[model samples]
Target chain A: MRERFITLTSPVVPLERDNVDTDQIIPARFLKATSREGFGDKLFHDWRYDSAGCPRPDFVLNDPTHRGTILAAGKNFGCGSSREHAAWAIRGAGFRAVLSPRFADIFRENALNNGLLPVQLPAPFLERVFTVTRERPEAAVTVDLERQEVRFEGETAPFDIPPYRKRCLLQGFDDIDYLLSIRDKIILFEKQHAL
Target chain B: MNTLFDKIWDAHVVEALPGDTHVLYIDRQYIHEVTSPQAFEGLRRRGVPLFRPGQVTAIPDHNIPTLCQHLPVADPLSRAQLDTLERNCVAHDISLFRIGTPHHGIVHVAGPESGLTLPGMTIVCGDSHTSTHGALGCVAFGIGTSEVEMALATQCILQPKPRPARVRVEGRLPAGTCAKDLILHVISRIGTAGGTGYFVEFAGTAIRALSLEARMTVCNMSIEMGARGGMIAPDDATFDYLRDRPFAPRGAAWERAIERWRALPSDDDARFDAEFTFDAGEIAPMITYGTNPATGIPVTATIPPAADPQALAYMGLHAGEPLVGKRVDHVFVGSCTNGRLEDLRAFASLVKGKRRAPGVTAWIVPGSQEVERRAIAEGVRDTLEAAGFVLRQPGCSACLAMNEDKVPPGKYCVATSNRNFEGRQGPGARTFLAGPLVAAAAAVTGEIRDPRELM
Candidate 1:
């Protein structure tokens, strides 16, 4: 499926919790959906909403004052389960980028494939974003997948994404596009091996 | 000198790309209800035909209720996910182990027992515990859904190499210690992030002596410590287990396969990026008192003061408190981690003459139809039933909060499954991971008692 260039320009919300697992991101109870869409409503389901389905005001995601398209969490964000629903929910909830010190391996790939950019920022930069966004709730941050750099508060820092992943995010090209492009090679290999 | 990992990995590399990336040729792909729907939908939308449909296996484990297998799934969402898998498997002409089938079970359990996972092969599943196949000396790792799409379309995946960590364990374990305890001890010594960016090779005599189910239990939790996966070089024990499986090679072909498998072990001169050693003698019947699996300790040990505050608060435990006698409302003995025949037998042996504690709810699920059948054949189910513990149908039940078997919020459950992450079993649910024997002990005693105490 064709995705759009993921350029984020918005304030970021802090999920300050450490080792935020995929089950915590989107509870397993809500993972029964066949389609990936409509997961935004259930994003952070247990934390963002209560037993009665009432939004928890204390939760950062539901706090009307801390609105943004990016979620900033601590280390090992999206760590536990490999369910891609966590990524779908993150993207579905209008977040284009998740700024973290480091991302759990699989979640990073899942987020990138679904058009949600997982930006690895230095500890200081992460702190700066938290400070800037808190002092100025209207603070705007930018993530440029093409340049592999993130801009915030008049400063920019470089991050690394595989060249192919960068190209996909920039061109709205899914990894499948590359696989499709290399179809002849795959066919040749399979035929050669009689696989 | 090549490690077992490198040998299998080198052969699977179909193409090398710039920036240290390669396209890995996948030999087997397993899918389940939760993470696979999106990938199948993507394949449908992109009009990508699966390159090797015959090598793929699809099942519904995460969403199926452990009870009432003959009836349609009652929950609409569960029904929808299962229906989607059934529909996609039919539409794509892929093999499926739908509920009630002899082959039906957890994806990780069903594949290997059916001889679908073999040595010297590369396997990927949408579920994290796919590492369980590594016990057979296969290079099996979990992939995200999009990567699943890549494997489906081309029977390959774009990948970067992972560093190998040789985790060597020496000494014979005390009788009560199971594979679950051995792995918990490993995770505790190395925090949850210890194996990040690495594939762990669990080696040494202690790992070698374990039965296939036990080795699988150890490998199945590789993801809990953030490993790409874990493997044990397949040996005579692995060969003996695979001999009579339906999909396994027959007669002379079996000998040929054994010859190939024999050559797959690491060379003596092989090196790893990092090395860790644990003495099996020190490993006790373990349980997680905190939220993550890495925060576990022997059941006899006191809860650490440094346990995660959030975990402590959610679990309603005080620092330095004894975990024993902390009333457990639920005792779950199932999941890819400990839902096999051996796990059921362990539970049965523990609870044979005693009835389940009135306050504790015991949920016992077999890992596969074969395991379920064997449990009945061995009268393990009858033993469990006599002890007032029902042997439910096979599925990944209560391992995560996906299915109907969720522990009610604020309830305490001692589970034999992998993760004990906060809210893993349900919202506000406190999970303590233990071996099946430990879980059985807790069920009969209605507390976090050591399995050795009962033995």
Candidate 2:
């Protein structure tokens, strides 16, 4: 079973660009592997590496000073393509939560299923977080799923997460477990609504 | 008052849990190579058998080589993935459509042409283009591997109900434009995040006038604008497209199916969470200049001055410059979005007598074996070959560059496929997403030109 995600307080890696798509998270070329693990090295493959396979220093992940467990990105994070590898890569790279003003629907679902916390804060709070993190790389932000709030530098903002998702994250529950428990209902429904 | 989305979604609800989540039963689940291996592995690890194996269909498309289907795949990794899919299907007793079979193609294309996608059914696949199936008026959307495993184990998924939105495009499309242009124009108006939490429905006179295949082209790219999925109410056009296909109902059953389908449209007083209306006459031949599909403008317009500079640098284009006269290095006209037979005909009609440009390399691929067969039988293939375009075998070629159709680094391609994401075609490749006519125009002129001028 994956680790339970309850609350996290850690420094963040800020990606200020909006519409950071899945292709930029994990390119199409790295998707040939059957296993979901071992993708941490390939996360953001194109943006992190040059043609020679050398790390590009200008990229955020390449910088040692900006290490963290949370990825604070601009709006529309995880747009384009429904590849869960993007979520897998982010988790494999050791991040626990993503703080964005918005997230694409499929990606949000994938992130939740795979144990990545997607925190949807307001745009103004995100702007403050970006500004504060830029000035102090080691500054930490706290995400409390139970309280449904994000706290940073004496400022706290309420975020919205469905109660079902919150319970699953708090207890390390899997959707498959819930789905498998209700097999009889599924069969009954299928028999009644035979297409 | 019920919307079409509500009619389909409510019927498929097996149970409703708290927090607005539902255990939605999926009628059809299509599996492909790239995303299904892990899902099958999930089943094996849990030691559970598939609940309804017959409801699932496996077809490998993403990583398969578009050329030489009979030959063994050269890439060891790609070959292993394909082999894994075949083995998994065999083990689970699920139906498989391997390469070289008459039924093989991209799942989105193969599903509709085989009549497996019908009105009011809930469909799903691991790939995002599963939204393409919603063109038949189904509540179809994409899922990840874990959800794929959930569907396999129980044929049901726990989903939070998405709100409904309506985009009504009225009036007739201008002569030079088609469904692709209309969708691109809509995406341009509504930025990538505009439809984030809603399932959008296409309505009004203009959408009703499009053919079934053309409607698929519109719904296929709904994800590009962040919608959960897109659909059009199943009409006579949709029924006619499915009437005689192999998997469709026949005789008395066909009549019954039509009777049910006729009730699938929204009622006159149905209300939506959001509504947007556009005049089809305002849309022109469209093209995307940036990395995302939403960064689109008319073919005759200059790049917006507010365009992202980093995106422009990566595309080797600059703001305040006319996109019309830019040189193009490659032209690709195939994908689940616009790779149907109708798309091929639109391409062939424009490039009929024109010679290929001196420096442009063009690849014309069919979406499915059925499309390929009809393209040849109807002389579209002959016309294309005469215009210096080679018709490649059917697959998702050049759309995501999973196979041998990668555009070289730093080269520009005018393509009719969806998603112009950076490195989507290949490493360092720049793509301009457009309809088939725009791609054909670039193929003949060796540059970006408004397809309207050519017509």
Candidate 3:
């Protein structure tokens, strides 16, 4: 049921904060579900809503002018717990990609597994994007996974992802399918190497 | 030429693909209710039985109420999750450490204590603190739900080899400081993103001198620094800790296992992609002043002027202000990070005859039922109770506040659990991460007094 990632061009939703941990993306209290859907409503739950359940105007997500499929964030994005729900919440919120100067290791993997591109751009380029998005909320950014580049404001920058992961994302291939196909090799490896 | 990480990693390779990706075999997988339900559902969707059920162990830690072992869970959703896990394990033939059982606890804590986690193995759990097993010298890290399902389907996951980094802490730790202080200091020096994209190996004399439990505390928070995982080379101390654990090898098998583990350390000439060295003697009892663990300082020091203003605003702290006398409303002394029997003993020693400060609530939770039982047998519970600190049953209590042990909004808590991120404990709770001694000092003093002063 996952979408095959190829390319996305959309206005950027700017969250100018560093170390946006998974706990903030989706708080621990919301992790009670057995399924992967519907986390979008609770995405950034504490920050999106006040205790009275009203949308906080100061939060970027509440800004009606800035709406996009690509989430642009500051350095060290998704830097805490390895909850895949963070990716689920992002995808559930309709974000197809997250662009940052850097990303936490586990979150990067989780994002990729969920077909949400984690675009790691140069620090200066990311800063330029943030500035552009801040000045013009409707500015669109283009991300091309096939080309491994992000383009915005007359500037284009290349990003890097492991080639294997890129293949998985492009084909919508799940690791579980590949792993299931190679059960014999795994059993052979286990038998040959006894712990 | 092989580092310890390379040795453990290379040994687990089922197949090496292009771009340094390996189909790495997982020797053990720890499961909990919070993260495993979806993974189990994934298996059901695919119509696959667990590939190696014996290698997986399921436990319910997160969302389980620490109080009332005999009672049904009050939260219907939480209870359903727990029931689903039991049903999945029963259907799949995976082992379940049921609640109220002696072995039931946090996966990271119970995994090592039961000897299911061994050196030179590749381990994982759905939880981030799976890195805690790396204290026993494994290539353990947290995985997402998809990866969890992949591991369950074949006991193998495709991963790119992480570049290795070494953090060497030399000299001796100062008195009153523990492994928590050393790690907090490391994070402060390196910043939260310092370890991103690397597997960090904690080395040098200070790390070596730590007891195994203390080493677990250090490795438990590797994820906080954005590292894939943190590991310490298994030494005699590690061997000693695992020797007689319930599931560890016996007699000749134990001897053989130790021999293999002894050879698991990095060669003298092995090279790491990044290296850092710090003096352990200079580290004081450390505490976080901001929402991130990296925003830490020695208890007696003033907050840095360069501290993130937004984080400062969230924490209700000002730059250049000393944290030594800040009032704390609660003290939580438990988590996979510092919730072992050793941690409780350290806490009990600090407040043996003293009383908890009035209006300051303290929850002293152990990491596991076994830890709780040992604390009681060792009289650590009595000391904690005598100090007016209630000894709570083991779960991830108040660490994530999933079980109603939340600190009220805007309350300041000095916590031994890892993470000071906003709303980690509750929606508006402010957490100051610290060691057990520091938590004890805060519990008794009702403020952020240095543990050294109390000592």
Candidate 4:
């Protein structure tokens, strides 16, 4: 029932590795809760935390300078298990969007349904953004869902979102909500198929 | 110009939206303990009842123990997830097979064997191994928990159509080589992410000649290559495997079923978006040496110089290190990938009349209660027990290490499961993915020797 997506202005965190998988994003041991709460503390649990459960200073996520509301990870991010928890962890960690050249299909769908914007930018533009964010850590970036544009420091790059998905984001509607919009068609199909 | 993937996808489309997306109807859905809890909660939160409860089959596999069926799950967290699934099933009026049920097993194994998955059906599950059902000529794929909730609210998912890629494996597989080796070999060539943005169809003589059980093994690891799913065109072999199964069509319905299934293959002149050909004769007993499944090498081969150094360090192997003669502390022969009855027989046959090498703990767990029962009746249990290998109760034991069957930290485990990702068996545990024959050889020799060595 939770549904809403809008413009966001925040910092960015760039994970500069390809093929980062779901297990590395959120380790299996932390996957016990039925509730999708407090996963922020456990994102990258094994990498971000020490054996004593203290934050590891070496991990980029624990480094205060790399703070951001957006996870600018590498291509094929969320590559392994089809766990929705990875997307939930991103949301719980207070990230509103993810930017990558490519994303694993299941993870992309999960993020979209859970109100996390997945923006696919070309490698050159992504590298430029990475440089800009690293140089000016506090530089506020804007992602306008309505205009389908991502802007930072007077520089702008346009992105694409499925028209139906854009409409869903703008109207705060989930797939079930959209399906309900066309319930009659579904009913007709089921009846015709004689299910 | 339609591939088998397209034929199934076209039939399942309820509506087409802009940007090549479709409102697709799902005929059957399977659920397991690890991913279904939150989806069930979401359903309750939305006050949404299951549209057609019978379309879904829920089972708890990932968190259950293989040794004890009558005892309560020891880990409180695992017990709670299992309990949540059971409660959700009863409240939603969906069919369920709990821990002690004869029908309860790994969803991937149970679906095809129970005839719940058949040709021309669109099947889905929260677990990625749902691709295993695609072996039956279905549009089978994995869905996330959010998608699971969506399907529960309305038996449909919004999906973007994928282009089709055909992988052709020619030449007959040599004796001692299995479907696992062929798939591993293909993954090694294509890398882990090569199949992205496509629904792959495995073709050519080598694939068609595989038995249904072997075909399932090949399809189960389709997710490891990052494909949405992989499918094989249905033939007489597919129908023969399904005939007279417990959930299959019967009598007059059976005759109609075969007639419909016979038409599920791709047209003769159809075109695919992409195609890659491989020689099956080049494949051998395969094993992975790195964290990802793509880092596989043949049994007689050595690690490559350019292999991931981080993975090599974690695995305690150097470049050019031969896979054979490396000591293995444990051997596991169960998971959705290789836990079927044929896999069990392959393992048992290799170890019969031989002693399990000292200090090598071998766990031979079946994928289902029926598999365990059948194995016992077929003397697989007797043979394995004679070799000092225990036939554990049926569940996904030691695969993901959610239960007591974990391989100890820093130890080497020769596994028949799909993924060999770092710590997949347990924290700091190293896994080597192989076919059951390789796993059986490791069990008897306490090392990574080829199965033919014992023969």
**Candidate 2 structure, TM-score to reference:** 0.99
TM-score of each: 0.97, 0.99, 0.99, 0.96
**Ten-residue stretch with the least lDDT total in model 2 chain B:** B60-69
Residue B406 in model 3: lDDT: 93
Model 1, position B115, has a per-residue lDDT of: 88
lDDT of 4 by residue, B1-455 (tens): 56788888888888999988799989999988788888888777777778879899998888888887799888998888888888888988889987778887899998798989999888889988898998888889988898898788788999888889888999999889888899999999987788887888999999999999899998888888888898999999998999999899999999998888787788888888889999999899999999988888998899998987888888999998899999999999999999999999999889999999999988888999889889999999999989998898878888888788888878999999988877778777899999999999999889999898886
Q: How many residue pairs clash in each candidate?
A: 0, 0, 0, 0
Q: Write down the lDDT of every candidate, Cα atoms only.
A: 0.87, 0.93, 0.92, 0.86
Ranking by lDDT: 2, 3, 1, 4
DockQ values of all predictions: 0.65, 0.86, 0.86, 0.63
Model 3 Cα lDDT, one tens digit per residue, A1-195: 457999899999999888899999999999999999999999999999999999999999999999999999989999888899999999999999999999998898899889999999998998888898888988999999999999998999999988888898899897887888889888888889998
For lDDT, candidate 1 versus 4, the one ahead is: 1
Per-residue alpha-carbon lDDT of model 2 for B1-455, expressed as tens digits? Answer: 99999999999999998888889999999999999988888888999899899899998989878778899999999898999999999999999988988888889999999988899999999988898998999999999999999999999998999999999999999998999999999999988999999999999999999999999999999999999999999988999999999889999999999999999999999999999899999999999999999998999999999999999999988898989989999999999999999999999999999988999999898999999999999999999999888888888888999887999999999999999999999999999999999998999999999987887
i-RMS, each model, one decimal: 1.5, 0.8, 0.8, 1.4
Per-chain TM-score of candidate 1, chain B: 0.99
lDDT by residue (A1-195, candidate 4, tens digit) is 465788988888878767778877776766777887778778887678766788988787888998878888778778878888899998899898998888887888888988999998777778877888778877777889999998878888899888998888878888887876677787788887742
Tens digits of per-residue lDDT, candidate 2, A81-183, equal: 8899999999999999999999999999999999899999999999999998889999999999889999999999998877888888899988999899988
lDDT per residue (tens digit) for residues B1-455 in model 3: 88999999998999988888889999999999988889999988988988889999998998888788679999999999999999999999999999899899988898899999999999989988899999999999999999999988899998888999999999999899999999999999998999998999999999999999999998998888888999999999999999899989999999999999999999999999999999999999999999999988999999999999989998999999999999999999999999999999999999988999999999888899999999999899889888888888889988998888998899999999998899999999999999999999999999999888877
Q: Which stretches of candidate 2 lie over 4 Å from their true place?
A: none
Off by over 4 Å in 1: A4-7, A154-156, A191-195
